[model samples]
Target: MLKPHQAKQAHGDSPNPVLSINQMNLVYNSTRGPITAIRDLTFSIRKGEFVSILGPSGCGKSTLLKIVSGLLRPTSGNVVLADVEVKEPRPDIGIVFQQPTLLPWKTVLENVLVPIRAMRMPVHEYKDRAHDLLRLVGLGDFINHYPYELSGGMQQRVGIARGLIHDPAMLLMDEPFAALDAMSREFMMDELQQIWMTTGKSVLFITHSIPEAVYLSDRVLTLSPRPGRVIDDIKIDLPRVRDVETMGQSMFGEYATHLRALFKSNTAPSTRIA
Candidate 1:
């Protein structure tokens, strides 16, 4: 693991990244004083690449996601998407939170179309697209089902479909499967990889699970304890179409082991590894 000073700017030399975070910093003014959540953070996500950000809890992992989605502005630095600076929420970006947050009253299909309705896009035009996305996520038959009728994993699949409804340039997922059971989480991992492969969209996934990150990412970026900054940028050379069997392979374990060591070495004493 590289020390803060030794950590190079992640993907600094990669050409044509779909999303770029340049020397980002975010501070929150509270009753106590100003708190810096992120410091000098820099990284890039290439087009159609699946990248994961791994760090201890409260290391600003989700905060970084919010900034990327333009929900929150950094105190300093910039988030550039496809050469355009993200100043406010843009219609072209999609976000999936830890919770599906699906509307209870709406059917799965209706929930998937919420973004389109909010953006004032022609609802009729996207109805077919929504059905296609649901089918892609393996929820074709559940399109008319309410959130209450689905399992936790099924609800999350709905969220994934909703995020892609607009065909955003990239997907920003903040631990989208964190709430699922162990079995469900594992299932979603494989499902998500298939979805990523099919869609060919850039993804910046945030998570605390080392195995999850290692299993899903083309590259994994580790951040330091609070006041988060990149500590290491690791490339996962494991072949794609990884399944449950792939997780048992030596290379997969090696990658997970290496990432676990990075957290142990670079994080503070209070930091907890998932």
Candidate 2:
């Protein structure tokens, strides 16, 4: 378990928080007994910030996102997004999961419009926005293509476009690149960073990769093992518009090394973030 005091000491004061999780806790009712998935996990994401949550599998990383997305209710505490308490799903929020989850029958452009349709928004109004987002994700030429016709990376790009179709203020990404090959994963990281930079959307990304978290995040939140707690909140001071070359720099290695050390000390090596 992480010592909250150490976490607070490491991150002396938080910036203006766009989302706040205060003393959050979650307990699962199992056949055996109650299982605590999270205990007093507290943190915040500031406006237009790219924050990554790093932790082991089954560490309530996804659970935390669910709560933040208003898909699930925490046993205690609350999640406030943009000063609005997230009691239920909100139209301004978007999510992209590990899998693309695109409708195979739907064209890339059609997939992007799913959210707008579900929200009962004027499809005509968001049609141009959808096309613009697809272009932003480098899928303009493939808008007519179906999911089956696209590569894994391209499909994930469609997922991202769909997430942004509604012009959401905040995006919740749950390991969106975890399913890709290492090369593709790295490529998607670059694309994602560029997209985030271009869109300026506040993002809360959940990932198990230490390097990915360090490379893509403005701040990395390290969580302890099961019954997760915030162990460390380290700010990445690297320059923006980071490219593959940035990965080879000394500072990148230092951040990766520091996070590796934290995982080794706080959680099992087998489930290390990297």
On TM-score, the candidate that comes out on top is: 1
- Write one digit per residue (lDDT tens) for candidate 1, span 66-142: 89999999999999998999999999899999999999999999999999999999999999999999999999999
C-alpha lDDT (0 to 100) for residue 195 of candidate 1? 94
TM-score for candidate 1: 0.94
TM-score of each: 0.94, 0.93
Candidate 2 residue runs with Cα over 4 Å from true position: 1-13, 269-274
Native-referenced Cα lDDT, model 2 = 0.88
RMSD of 1: 3.1
Model 2, span 1-274: residue lDDT tens: 2233323233523577888898999999999898888989888888898999999888899999889889899999988887889999998899999999999999999999999999999999988999899999999999999999999999999999999999887999999999999998999999999999999999999999999998999899988888898978878888988998899998888788878878777776775433
Residue 129's lDDT within candidate 2 is 93
Clashes per candidate, residues 3 or more apart or on different chains = 0, 0
- Judged by whole-model lDDT over C-alpha atoms, candidate 1 comes out at 0.90
